[model samples]
Each structure stands twice: as C-alpha cells, then as structure tokens.
Target: MTGAAERMRDRQMTDGMALNPAGPDLAEAMPPGVLREIEPRHLEEPRGRYHGHAGLLAAPHNVEEVAAVVRACAAARIGIVPLGGGTGLVGGQIMQDGPLPLLLSLERMHAVRDVYPQENVMIAEAGVTLQSARDAAKDSDRLFPLSLASQGSAQIGGVLSTNAGGVNALRYGTARALCLGIEAVLPDGSIMHDLKRLRKDNTGYDLRDLLIGAEGSLGIITAASLRLVPPPAANGVALIVVPDPAAALDLLSLAGRQLGDCVTAFELISGQGPRFQMEKMPDLRQPFDSAPDWMVLIEIGLPRGLEPDTALEALFEAAAEAGLALDGLIAQSGQQAADFWRLREEIPEANRLIGAISSHDISLPLSEVPGFIEDAGAMLADMGNMRINCFGHLGDGNLHYNVFPAKGRDRAEYDDIRKRIQASVHEMVVARGGSFSAEHGVGRLKVADLERWGDPARLQAMRAIKAALDPLGIMNPGAVLA
Candidate 1:
C-alpha cells in the first residue's frame, strides 16, 4: 500500500473498494471508550444528497485520543472520514460508495480552551459550536463575526475545514482569514502543533492554511486559535428595494462610496425568496407588504459618535437621487434589525423545504454578477419550467443560485434534467472566470466538477501534496480528489 503503483491503483479504487478490511484489527487498536456505535446522523449530510457507510465510529475525547484513533486507522488501511457538526451541504462529511471508513467525530472535544482578551484571540476545541464560540467572545465584550444559520450546530473545526464565508465576509473576511493557527493531526497520525496566538509568523510552508480548507483530505483540525474583533459602537440595518440586479450592484457601489469599511454586509435578495417564505413558512413575518422584484439588505457598523440610522438615511437619499433605489426601510430598533436579518437568513431553509432540482454555490467577479444572473435566468427559463431563488452575500460575489420545480410540481420529476442544469450553470460560470465551488469546499458532490474545471497545474500540485501527506489515500476517500 505504500508503493507508488499501489497509491495510483488506490486512487482509481477510492470510490470502489477498501484497500484492506479492518473489522477486528482496527477495533483492537482503538483507545478504550473511543469506539462508540455509529449513529445515523454521522452518515447523513444536510442536503440528503449523500449517505455513507462506517465500519467504526470513534469519538475522541481529546487530541491525544484523536491522534491514537487516526494512527490505528492508518495501520489498518481504513479510510477515516472526520465528522464535525454534519451540517455540510456538499457531502464532505459523508463517504458514499467508498470503503466503510472509520467515522471520526470530535463532538466530545467541545471546549473553549482559553480566551486572551488582550490579544483578541480565542483558543477553542474543534467540536465547540460557532454559537458557543460567539457567546464566549461576547462574555469578554468582543465579537465573533463568522456567522451562519447553522451556527447553533456547525462546529468550529468543520467551519475552518470548509473555510466558510458567511454574511459578514464583506467586513470580517472568511474563516481562513479569521484563523490565526491550528492544532491538527496529519494523515500519518503525527500532530502539528502550530496553534500560535501571534498574528504574524514568517515560518516555512504555511500548513495551517493548507489544512484550514482541505476538507479533511490532508489532515484533521483538532483545535484552533481564532481571531476575534471588537464589537462596533453603533450598528444599523436596512432593506432597500432595487429595480433590478443592475441597480442592486450600483447601490452596492454607492454604499461603498459612503460607508467604506463600516458597510459590514450587503446581501442581494430576489423576489422569489419572499414568495417562498410566504408559501412554506407562513408564520414568519414578511418585511414588505408585497414582494419586490429585487432588494439589497445592508448592515453598517460605525464608531461611537456616529448615528447608524442617520448614516443610512443619507445613503438612501443619495441612492434615490441616483435612481438606484426605489424604496427602503431603515431599522428603528434592534428587534427590527434582527427581523431584517431573519428575512435574509431564512431564504436557504425555505428553499430547502420546497426542494431543489439543482443548487449552485458559485462566485464571480463583482461586475459580472448582475450580467450572469440575468443571462442565467433566461437560459434556465428556456431549459425548463423551474423557479430560481438567487441570493447570497452580494458584496463578496458569492451567490446561492438554486433552482426549484415550478408550481405544483415535485423536484423528483426533474431528475432527468438535473445533471444537465448543473452542468450548464457551471459551464457558464467557468466561461466567465467564476468558480463552480465558492465558499463550500469540494466534497464528494463536486469532485467531478473540480476535475473538470480545476486548473491543471494547481490540480497537479494538489494531487502531489495529497500523495505526499496521505500516501495510503485513506483520509476521506473519494473526496476533494478522484
């Protein structure tokens, strides 16, 4: 299994067979109390797109146990699929059609190791939920701006592993940018203790960044030193109706001109979003009397002396004068701000309830966004009778462009054309120099997409690194690579 020939053959069989079966040998090698019974949740992903098989479930209590479990799995040649919150949409946590991997769950490692307020850093275990991390930061009067709707369940390890980009990405950046260091176990079960709290280190080869978004292919991130920001003195939210995607983009430019870094988040919402919410989630209140064709949700954070509402009103007036804004609402209170955000955050869940024939998390150049949306919508309409819910962090060019069946039709009926729809969308995205997989890492779902659209030299280097680190190809088989 260590030879080059064996490695090449193993890559071919990553989704086909296990190199070696480790039913009893792996069991005997596990640390006591580390081998728990596999649960249904560990094998299921958020979108119900992938279901995996687990020969063993190892819930390591700490990094030492985590290393030991990895070492044992390496010895047995058993593929190891690291499990965190299991909230990933792209099936990174699941290993369908591969070897019955050892499911490595870090839920037991949930602990905020330390918080150094002076350094503006928090050292937290991989299993700690994002909500818990945020709560800890708040206790010290700081802010953890890396947010997601799944924050209540998405663990820190998976967040960094995926290098997630939430709404605040316009201001705070992605998970990779926010992380200072990490404590991880390499594929060979050796630990890399690079979890330093310092902001700058010019060390050789930055493996911390390598593992951050590797999607558990290179190694397991057991813990991290995450960067935290100071809470803004004043904050405001506004929902401004734009005539179209073009106007929304223009409004974004205007907001940038006026607010600069104070503009924390700028989200684009299609009218389909509010309609879907009304149809599926009847109890959740709508922000507008009627669903506008398009709108932009803006949030600004200012220094102590500035008034957020005043700033927003002035910005809206400028936008109206420029003919970029039709109507808008500035949050008068904190509850109203939360409600505005709720309208933006709940779109994904509503889309899920309605079921999607095809979903894309794609990103493009800022200027290309409006054009891509309009062209994509026209193309999709010609393809089939489908509804589009195109929305996401517009400030960052990441769009959760999802397609659903038309009214009174089930998504199951569109199965035949689903593959074509995804391929067409990705083709357009790549032709325009956009990425098929944006914030979400390339899990089992997008491996083919990666192979098709991935840059040749970059993909070669990635494969070389994978082979060098994981010679046996046992870490998350059939993921990230072929």
Candidate 2:
C-alpha cells in the first residue's frame, strides 16, 4: 500500500489532470533535465499543505535546484510561485488567476550555513525555520530575534520576503532591520550573491532591502545573513488592563520615556481577542477578573547585574499614578510569562477558527492610533452587530483591524462584505496619513487595492524595477506589483 505522501501526490496529480484536461499537466510539462532533478513522486504528489493560487508544484532542495526550475519555467514563459511555510494570511503564497504557474518550494533547502557569534551574524539557508535559527543563536549564547505567530512553520525566506514584524520590534526592530544580506536566485536563474555580513557597505543600490519585501516578485531568496544580539539576563512581563486605546498609548509613552531602550515589547489586546482565547483555548484565563476594552502587554529586559522586578514595579507605579493603567497582572515566573504571551500570539488562530472576517493590517503615526481607534471602531460598530478585534503593535501604531459577522450569520454572507469593509478601513487609514499595507506585503490579495491607492510615481518605479530585473515576468507573478 502507498504511504500518505504518495497518496497525497497522486491526489494532486489527479486534481491537476482533472483541472487541465485539454493541456499537459504540471508534471507532464516539466523540462527534461528539471524533471530528472525532481523526484517523480514529488512532482505529481503533495509534500505539504497546499492552498491559495499556486498549489502543489515541485519541491527543490538547494539553490541550484531552485534556479534550474526557475530557468526552465522562464524559458517556457511559465509563471513561478515560490512557496515556504504557507503561513501568509494575505494569500501571498497562493497562485492566482493567471498562467498556470510552477510552484517552486524552498522547504527542502534548510541548512545552517554559518554562525559567527563574534561577528554578530548567522548565515542560514532560506528553508531554515525561524525557531531553528533562534535556537542556533541561543546555543551560541547569542540572540536571533525575528519572531511571529507561525515561527514554527514559517521559513526565513518567506519571513524576509514579507518583512515580518513581531513582538520584539519595539526593541530590536522588524525583519528588514534584522537582515544584513541575502543570497537569492533571480527570475532568469542568475544568482545574486550579496550575502555580506558587515554593517556598512554603501557601495551602490541596496539590493538586500529590495528582495526583503519583494514578496517573491523580483527573486527567490535561497540564503540570508541575519543580525543577532546578546541575550538579556532577565525578563519582566506585565498584563495591564487599560480603560481604552488612548490610555494604552499614554502608558506606551511612559514606557518609552522612562525605560528608554529597555522597553522591549508593547502590544495591545482587545477584550474580544482575549475572550475568544478563553472560549477556544480552554486553559487560558483572563489575567484580570474584569475585562477592559483594551489591554497592554509590556515586556522589559534587565541588563546583567540589574534586577527586573524593581524597575518593573517602579514603572507600574508610575503608570498607575498617572491614571494610564487600571489594573495589571505581572507574571510571577518565566512559565507564566510564556503562558501570557501564548494568548497574545494565538489570536490569529482563534480568529481563523471562527471563520471569514474582514482583516486589515495597517500602520499609522504612533500618536494617531487613539484617534484612528475611536473613529474606525465607531464607524464599524454603527454598520451592524459585527464584532471588532482592534489590537496589535501599539508602540508602532500597527493595528490588525478584524471584524467578525453578527451571531448566527452564514460565512458566505459575511465574506460578501469583505470588499466594502476593506475599502472603508483603508480609506480611514489613508485619511489618517497611514499605510494600507504595513508589515504584511502586498501579495495577490491586495494587488487591486494597492493599484488604486498606491502612489503613481512609486508604482511606476516599482514596475520599472520589475521590468528591469525580470523582463519575462517569470518571478512569482501576480504578486506585489500587480
């Protein structure tokens, strides 16, 4: 009897054959050399979870294998959809309505190339898991701080491509800031080796910055050199309930002003978000007995020889005295801190289980967060009985504006309002001098919206760069620039 992988592969081929009855299937159309390079079973078989536009195509092991596939697709004028952990919420990894693209997966190219603790750099292959890299750094007594909800599955390539922002961004910065250099395979199969680990090299154009947030539209990243830091001696975590988003902002200001660089994390949570966790996670309990409209998760790290408790206590006292903090829950131990963070990190999963909702990941000037919250929340509440979960990197003013349907409403009915909700929220974002797309890159999901609202000159320049680098348009087509 065939194993599960074989069965999945066979099922995919059967589906592909059924979908393309008149033409040759994906496996049948593969070039001769490329076909031999890929295992026959892997081509017509599914190796992992397949979703979005481009489904299961082929899995590549190294840079050469990936380049070979891209070269073959380029010669044949076929689109190439690059897949990693497939954890993108904006449909970034999905294939779209266009040329039946060849899916180039980097799942097999995982390797830790080099670790330089002295130089503060770690070179990892594209397929290396975020947690794996972090662990490697930890083993060396260093710190690799790029993190997210799906770090277990999301690869370095996808994270860099999307420029992911996580909890620690308030201290260390986003993925773009953490990445020093990259080794990528261009659309036409040429290798662009700019993986230099140095801090300053102002030679010419910053190619690394371009590829970091390109969303696979320009090239496929194979390896990367990331910046690492020294681990903190101790951590201080607090779960504070605030009266509103405004108070959270004031508390954030206090943390920034008083603690300076020690303020490592400043995240916001809504009552609905935590309530969902309490209902779904079962073991999760509200840290405070009474629920507030908004909550703040603050984390600070102490230097060697310094105590965290004293500093944290003093900060909390200041916040309470200033009337910015209502009530708070300080984690008594590291495990308790982990438990508190798990609740914040699992919000997306909780929302996913609930069903389709209009989600917006937008950013604004940090000071404007409170106004945006009031206006957007009031406007959305007036629409109907929809449930809104407004929370995220409050220190950065990036809110994940998610709206759920009224109780007992069918998913299909709620999904129909997605476009309307997006337009309204995006308009609010633009009105407040904010960005429509923040950490999450403009994948196929937001192409039309980007086209409509994106600055004309910037769009033209991006198109020109795309045409300059990928004239054949073989790189992950129908993404970002589209």
Deviation of model 2 at 339, angstroms = 1.3
Clashes of each: 0, 5
Clashing pairs in 2: 9-45, 9-46, 53-94, 53-95, 54-95
* Model 1 misplaced stretches (Cα beyond 4 Å): 1-18
| Candidate 1 vs. true structure, TM-score | 0.97
Residue 411 of model 2, lDDT score: 51
Give a tens-digit lDDT track for model 2, residues 1-482: 11322332353345442122112445554444333233332222121222434433667777777777777676666677777777776666765354356777787788999999999999999999999999999999999987787788889999999999987888899999999999999988888888999999999999999999999989999999999999889888988888888889888888878878988889999998877676566676557665577889888987888777777778889999999887888889998899889878888877776654688899999888889988987888777668888779987778888888766774567666677888999999998899988888787667777878888999999988987898766676667765
In model 2, the runs with Cα more than 4 Å from the true position are 1-56
- Candidate 1, poorest ten consecutive residues by summed lDDT: 1-10
User: What would the per-residue lDDT of candidate 1 be over residues 404-461, giving only the tens digit for each residue?
Assistant: 9999999999999999999999999999989998898888788888878899999999
Query: How well does candidate 1 score on lDDT at residue 396?
Result: 92
lDDT of each: 0.90, 0.78
Candidate 2 CA-lDDT value: 0.78
Write down the RMSD of all candidates, one decimal each.
2.9, 6.8
